[model samples]
Each structure stands twice: as structure tokens, then as C-alpha cells.
Target: MARKVIESVTCDACSKKGLEVPGTVNLTVMGDRYDLCDEHGARFRDQLAAALAPAVDAALSA
Candidate 1:
């Protein structure tokens, strides 16, 4: 018989229960791992992209 390992994770932004599946996005920022649900993960991704857009544009222009 084989044993299964389950990893329980919760969303860092909203503290909501996460799906805890292979497709879940686990983000490590500043040496801390944050688990996020689909909604919060999307929001975080969008915000991060928006924040980095200016720097990316500046670097490209330079």
C-alpha cells in the first residue's frame, strides 16, 4: 500500500482556504513563501506586473 501526502495551504492575502493542488501558485518573496487562491493570486500577479511595468519600460528605453 502506498501513502499519500497532502499539503494544506491557505491564501496569504485573504487567508482563505486554497485548492492546494499542483496548479496552485506558490510565490516566494523576500524568502517567505505565500500561498494564494486563484482570485488573490490573479490580483497579486496583476499588481506585480503593473508595478514592474514602469521599470521594464525604462530599462527597455535605456
Candidate 2:
């Protein structure tokens, strides 16, 4: 059993004063978590989808 921890995170894609959007997007890659704002979150989602599309298509075709 492993213990889970949750902490506040600032958006990694933006660098502006008071621009931190907490509790927005929590993305986990290879066991590491990243928090992003709405804009960056959407971009990340789209990029992830595009990256996975090829593998998904191949899997479906097989």
C-alpha cells in the first residue's frame, strides 16, 4: 500500500504575477504529476491526443 499526497501546484507554462490557477489540471506522466492552467491544460490535452493517435490507430487496425 502506498500513501497518496496532494499539494497545491502552480502552472508550469505561465510566468505572470498572480496567474497561478490552482486545482485546475493534474496531469501524471511516468508517476510524476503536473498542474497546469486552463490554456496550458487544453494544449497539453491536444498534444497528448495527437501523440497517442498513431498508436491508437494501429491498435485499432490490428
Which candidate tops TM-score? 2
**What is the overall TM-score of model 2 with all chains considered together?**
0.70
Q: How accurate is candidate 1 locally (lDDT)?
A: 0.75
- Which runs of model 1 end up more than 4 angstroms from their true locations? 1-5, 16-23
Instruction: Give a tens-digit lDDT track for model 2, residues 2-49.
Output: 999988677866635556566478789999987788888999999999
lDDT of 1 at 25: 70
What's the CA RMSD of model 1 in angstroms? 3.7
For candidate 2, give the lDDT of residue 25: 80
- Model 1 scores worst on lDDT over the 10 consecutive residues at 15-24
Query: Candidate 1 on 1-62: residue-level lDDT in tens?
Result: 99999976666666534334333577788999887777777888999999999999999999
